[model samples]
Target: MRVFYAVVLLAAVLVLNFSLMHLAPGDVADTISQSMGGADQEILDKIRADYGLDKPFLVQLGHYIGRVLQFDLGHSFFFNQPVTQLILQRLPATLLLVISAQILALVLGVVLGVYSARKPNSIANYFVTFFSLFGYSAPVFWTGILLLIAFSLKIPWFPVAGMRDVTISGGFWIQFWDVARHLVLPMITLSSIFIALYSRLSRATMMETLGADYIRTAKAKGLSNRQVIYKHALKNSLSPVITQAGIQFSAMMSGAVLVEAVFSWPGLGTLAFQSIIARDTPTILGILFFSALVVIVGNLLTDLALRLVDPRVGGRK
Candidate 1:
C-alpha cells in the first residue's frame, strides 16, 4: 500500500515538474542561440526537434513517462552526458553529507536532550534551549559562511570547499583525511538544524515520560535513577522523536541545496543548482525525482522504526 501511494505521488510530481518547466518563460531555442552565439531559425528548429521540445505537451510528457519507467533519465543537454550518470556521480557526495550530518544530529541531540531533561531548570537545560533556538533560527547559508570564515580563513583549520582535493598525491588514508577535512564544515552546517529539532523534541518528550505513571512506578519499585530514565522512560519517549527524525531526515535532504551551494560541495544539490542556471530540464527533473524518492523512503523507514520501537503503533487497522 505504501508502494502504491509512493508511485502515485511520484507520477504526479513528475507531471508537475515537467509541465512547470515547459510553462516557464523564455524559449529554449533563444537560450540555446545565446549560448551558441546566435543560430538561425533552421538550426534552432533542429535543436528543438532533436531534444523533442517541438513535440506537443502531452506527447512530450508521454515520452518522458515512458523513459522514466525504463529507468532512463535521458541526456543532459548542457552537460552532453546521461542524466543518470551525472546523478550517480554526484549522489555519493550528498549521501555522505546527509548521512553523516543526520548521525551527528541524532547522537548529539539525543545526548543533550536526555541530559537537559534530567537537569530541569539548571544551566544545562537553558544552554540546550539557547542552542536549539540559535540553530532553528539561523539561516543555512549564513551559518555556512560563518563556519567557512572561522575555520577556513581566520583559524585555518579546514579546507574552504569541494569534497576532496584530487591534486594531492597520496595513498587511500591520505585522500580519506583530505575529504573528511572538507566535509566537516558543510556537515556541521547541515546538521545544526536537525540537531536543534531533535534535541528539543527529545527533551520535551523525555520530560513528559519522566513524569508519567510508569516512570513513577519504576522509581517506587527501587529502580535506580539511571535505570528509570534510560531503561524505562527514554524508551517510551522515543516514539515522537523517531517520527521527528523521519521528518528532519527529509528536511535535511531538501535543505542540502543551500548548504551545498554555500560550500561548493559538488553534490546533488550543486548539480541541480548548475542545471537550473543552464536551464537543463532533464538534469533538474532527475534530481528532483530522486530527491522525492529519498524523502518518501525516509518517511517509510521512520514509520517502520516507530512500529518496532512501540508495537502498539499500527498494530490495529
Candidate 2:
C-alpha cells in the first residue's frame, strides 16, 4: 500500500512540476539567444523546434512523461548531456555531504540532548542551550560564510572551495583523507542547524521519558543509571527525533544548494543553480524529480527504522 501511494504521489509531483516549469517565463531558446547576444526570429524558431518547444503543452508533457517512464530524464540544454547522466555524476558528492551532515547532527544532537536532560541546570546544559539557540536562529548561508572566513581564511585550516585537492597525488587512503578534510567544513556548516534541532527535541523527550512510570519502575528494580537511561528511556525517546530527521531530509537537500554554492561543491545543488541560470528546464525538472524521489525514499526508510525501534508502531499501523 505504501509503495502504491508513493508511485501515485510521484506521478502527481511529475505533472505539477512539468506544469509549473511550462508556465514559467522564458524557455531554453530565450536563454540561448541571450547568451549569443541576439538572434533573429528564424534562429529562435529553429531552436524551439529543435528542442520541441514548439509542441503544445499537453503534447510536450506527454512526451516528457513517456521518456521519464523509460528512465530517461531528457537532455540538458546547457551541458549538452543526458540529464540522468549529469545527475548521476554529481549525486555522490551531494549524497556524501547531506548524509554525513545528517549523521553528524543526529549523533551529536542525541548525545547532547541526553546529557542536558540528565543535568538540567548544569553548565553543560546551559552551553547546549546557547548552541541550539544560535544554531537554530542563524541562517544556513551566514553560518557557512562565517566558517569559511574563520577556518579557511583566518586560520587556514581547510580548503576554501571544491571537493578534492587536484594537486595532491597519493594512494587511496591519502586521497580519501583529502576528501574527508574538504568535507569537514561543509558538513559542519550544514549540520549545525540540525544538530541544534535534534538536541533540543531529544532533551525534551528524554526528560519526559525519565519521569515516566516505566523509568521509575526500572530504577525501583535496581537498574543502574546507565542501564535505565540507555536501555529504558533513550529507546522510547528516539522515535520523534527519527521522525524529524525524515521530515527534514528534503529541507537539507534544499539547504545544500546555498551551502554548495558557497563552498563551490560540485553537487546537484550547484547543478540546479547552473540550470536555473541557463533556463535549462529539463535539467531543473530532473533535479527536482530526483530530489523528490530521494525524500520519499528517506521517509520510507524512516518508517522502517521506526518499526524496528518500536514494533508497536507497525502493529498500530
Candidate 3:
C-alpha cells in the first residue's frame, strides 16, 4: 500500500511540476533568443519548432509524460546535454552534502539533547539552550558566508569554493581528504539549523521519556544512571526525532540550494540554479522530479526505521 501511494504521489508531482513550470513566464526559446542577441520572429519560431515547443500544451505534456515514463528526461537547451545525464553527474555531490549534513546534525543533536536532558540545570545544558536558539535563528547562507570569511579568508584553514582541489594531484586518500576539507564548511552550515531543531526536540522528548514508569522501574531495579538513560529512555525518545528527520528531508534539500550556491559546489542545487536562470525547462523539471522521488523514498525508509525501532508501530506483534 505504501509503494502504491508513492507511485501515485510521484505521478501527481510530475504533472504538477510540469504544469506549473510551463505556465510560468518565458521559456527556453526566449532564453535562447536573448542569449543569441534577440532573434527575429522567424528565428524564434524555428527554435520553438525544433524543440517541439510549437506543439499545443496538451500535446507537449503528453509527449513529456510519455518520455518520462521511459526515463527520458529530454535535452537541455543551454547545456546541450541530456537532462538525465546532467542530473546524474551532479546527484552524487548533492547527496553527499545533504546526507552528510543530516548525519552530523542527527548525531550531534541527539548527543547534546541527551546530555542536556540528563542534567537540565548544568552549565552544559545552559550552553546547549543558548546554542540552539542562536543556531536556529541564523540563516544557512549567512552561516556559509561567515564560515567562508573566517576559515577560508582570515584563518585560511580551508578552501573557499568548489568540491575538490582541481590543482591537486595525488593518490585516492589525498584526493578524498581534499574533498572532505571542501565539504566541511558547507556541511556544517547546512546542518547547523537542523541541529538546533533536533536538539531541542530530543531534549524535550528525553525529559518526558525519563519520567515514564518504565524508566523509573528500570532505575528501581538497580540500573545505573547511564544504563537507564542510554538504554531505556533514549530509544523511546528517538521516535519523534526520527519522524521529524524524515519530514525535514525535503527542507534540507531546499536549504542545500543556498549552501551550494554560496560554496559553488557542483551539485544538483547549482544545476537547478543555472537551469532556472536559463529557463531550461527540461533540466529544471528533471531536477524537481528527482528531488521529489528522493524525498518520498526517504520517508519510506523512515517508516522502515520506525518499524525496526518500535515493532508495535507496524503491528508486528
- Candidate 1: 10-residue stretch with minimal lDDT: 24-33
Q: What clash count goes with each model? A: 0, 0, 0
Give each prediction's root-mean-square deviation over alpha carbons.
Answer: 1.6, 1.1, 0.9
**Residues 186-208 of candidate 3: C-alpha lDDT, one tens digit per residue:** 99999999999999999999999
Off by over 4 Å in 3: none
Q: TM-score, each model?
A: 0.95, 0.98, 0.98
Residue pairs clashing, model 1: none
**Alpha carbon lDDT of each predicted model:** 0.91, 0.96, 0.95
What range of 10 consecutive residues in model 2 has the weakest lDDT sum? 308-317
Whole-model lDDT for model 3 versus the true structure?
A: 0.95
Shift of residue 177 alpha carbon in model 1, Å: 2.5
**lDDT agreement of model 2 with the native:** 0.96
Candidate 2, residue 186: lDDT:
92
TM-score of 1: 0.95
The predicted structure with the larger TM-score, 1 or 3, is 3
